[model samples]
Target: MNQIITFGEVLMRISPRGNKKFIQSNNVEFYFGGTELNVGISIANFGGDVKHISCVSNDFIGDTAISYLRKFDVSTSAIVRSNRPLGVYFLEVGAVMRPSTISYNRSHSSFSEIQPEMVNWEKSLKKGKWFHWTGITPALCKGGKETLLEGLKLARKKGMQVSADPTYRSGLWKYGENPREVLSELVNYSTVFIGGVNEMNELLETDFSYSNEDFIEASKQLMLKYPSIEKVFDKIRTSINSSWHKIRARMWNGKDFKETLDIDITHIIDRIGTGDAFAAGIIHGLQKFDDYKTMEFGAAACAIKHTYLGDINYANEADVISILEGNTSGRLKR
Candidate 1:
């Protein structure tokens, strides 16, 4: 299989110590995370050949962030260095009934300043079988949005499959472009679209309900508009509290709408990167698993990510398959 290439801005994630509020915590944990980078890392953890493309600051902080990705077997050769500082986001892990929150400190960051001509998209994307980008990239800046569209257009011209997870972060779309208009243009190039009824309603300016019928109708409408889109996926989470949740995966395969069994997660270690893990599983499973089976893998991967404390899902194939195979007993191996 050819490599998967992901494009986006990664940030240094700093979180308060263990369920403590930002004001109460004196210490914090740090990690490197971004929507597309998390997807790339999850694919790498599953032993896929993945490369991440973006510019980071030409400094120690950026170097440390890329080094962290290298530990997971993600290729950083396409990463460019810039004089701007690295982006940062401070996370506050929530407890029972308290949802998590993230505050961005990413203005003027390296990736936000990146231009279309800075990287050679033809060289990087032409060699890959799949190209992935997130809505977060375009929300960073006008230059970033233009660069992402340029890469997407080039990747399509080269016959590479395209996947998009249009994450709607209201905090980042401050670069003078309307979120809906910008995302509409970028999503048109995607072959596989990942988002739900709420995401669709908000990003596309529709008033769809959170029901199966509405989701299917919304996806069909999107497919009609973007003729290249073949598959649309989204996951549902039923959170009883901050620590316990049940996640179910669903998809529309341009034919039938299918949903996976809900995987109940009793104890959550972290909730920050579960969606990214789901996206990664969908990307990987589309090549390895069949149509609806892809949702099984995706939902399972998301359930497993709730067991880890970091921003990235560290579960390997066997780990996710354990959940997929209905072996969620959490037993120890001899």
Candidate 2:
């Protein structure tokens, strides 16, 4: 019975309700989203003892975020309140060769101001078997980097397993530090590592050709470079357009690598947060089962995420298991 703890900032995502652009739409739909928070919520929904630790503003948006987390039964006692505003991001999903663009307004966010003293590392991490985080947390600012380092140190001292997603967002690293410098340092503490090949190459300063064997080889090389990492997981996607894509995933569990067959997605309701969903699935599968078949479960969860709007909360274990059983016809239920 291992408990999972996630540390990061939660943001209010404002995206146009439909296909309308930001300038054309007078109103936008609001959803609570953050890398670590999204994963924690999904894990909690799947009936895991999960907790989210972060700083939030004492504003309407922050209050709504707390309420939303409560709806999923996630613990918020570790959250700190501040007068600073919560971070926000605007998303404009694109079609064809144009990729989605996200504009972040996260400067001076409450989480960015978090200090090492704000977290009771001993209590929050007590009895915790797993600690999760992302590259975005360390990229926030000087204070954020320091806070994450402290959390990782405490986790290591307590002998808790650590996982990290080097989710590279180029725009988020503006603290006068190169992504490679910051990410490599943080990744040194992770036991489970997840990220894209592009991100890995950028951080490691090497070029890797894409192939199943090459991917696994690169991951093994990375594991050797960082002795703390015992596993590496990645999602592979082929986008045909904004609405359709083919996706699969792979994992390296210290000794060998395994991959899942590609799934052809017909319609994508929302492309955001699918990666986090995949990460949640991996965490769930690794914690519950001992087989490589968990890779298929994780990939199926990501496929289901593309068919839904908003964040990872809408995903369910049944849907993922169904997909894993090869039910891609998507027949409606009564």
Candidate 3:
């Protein structure tokens, strides 16, 4: 199996039990995850060798977060310790017509305080075949942007594939740096683009519609602008409500364009981390399957994530394959 490297923050997610709001529940459950961490964990669960690099508090919470990654066989040796507390967010899971709400308290967290000199990129990418990152990292702090840029440069020099998911969150970019300029600089080192029309528009400053024809044209323009990006994969989610969703995926590999059938989830257990799961699946499938099959695998992995609760997708390769084979009957294995 090819080894994949993921770089980002590790966050502690606190949520009221089930569908209850904080005001209605005295109890809460905590899980450790971040956008990149979730992808690393999901890829690790799929029998891939994944190492996650991040900074955590030099406290029990950080220790517990490292342990959580270890439980899923994700490597933690690259993780660093800092005096700053671990990042945290409070989640309220909603149902039916209600939507989930989240409040972040990670502005001054350990991961945000990471320095570029703290990590040796040459050693970190020694055995890595792929490197993954999201926009959340660079938006946090200057240190994060510099550190990730260093890693991306090394990964590209090593001839390793790099995947970029430029997830734009308007609320996260308080550091005065233009997201477009920063993301454009970083994404130039990536080989695969893991987002859709909105991401392209954000990076290219173009207003592209959501139509398939427009998506294809936008992808063409994106590849023309960033020649390093060889392929683009997008996950489309059609939500009927907070509890029900339909997942579909499409891709453009410079020459061919393919899309998958929608995989409907009439009941969703957890909506978080589903997109990360899709990214993980695509990264894993690129080595083991064809392009169209890889897109199907990604969509299948995404649909399966809705059946579980928490910030990570617990589905393995076999589980995703089952879904791809149309075995979503949810029957007992026995």
Candidate maximizing TM-score: 3
| Order by TM-score, highest first | 3, 1, 2
Q: Higher TM-score: candidate 2 or 3?
A: 3
Model 2 residue 193 CA deviation in Å: 1.1
In the range 80-108, model 2's lDDT, one tens digit per residue, is: 88899999989987666666778889999
lDDT computed for candidate 3? 0.94
Q: Which stretches of candidate 3 lie over 4 Å from their true place?
A: none
Q: Pick the candidate with the highest lDDT.
A: 3
**Model 3 agreement with the true structure over 1-334: per-residue lDDT tens digits:** 2689999999999999999999999999998899999999999999999999999999999999999999999989899999999999999999999999999999999998899999988778888999999999999999999999999999998899999999998899998999999999999999999999999999989999988888899999999999999999999999999999999999999898888999989999999999999999999999899999999999999999999899899999999999999998888987
Worst 10 residues of 1 by lDDT: 197-206
Per-prediction RMSD in angstroms?
1.3, 1.6, 0.8
- What is the per-residue lDDT of model 1 for residues 91-146, given as tens digits with 9 covering 90 to 100? 89888888888888988888887988888987777569999988888988999899
Candidate 3, TM-score vs. the true structure?
0.99
User: What's the ranking of the predictions by lDDT, best on top?
Assistant: 3, 1, 2
Clashes (candidate 1): 0
For candidate 1, list the clashing residue pairs, or say none. Answer: none
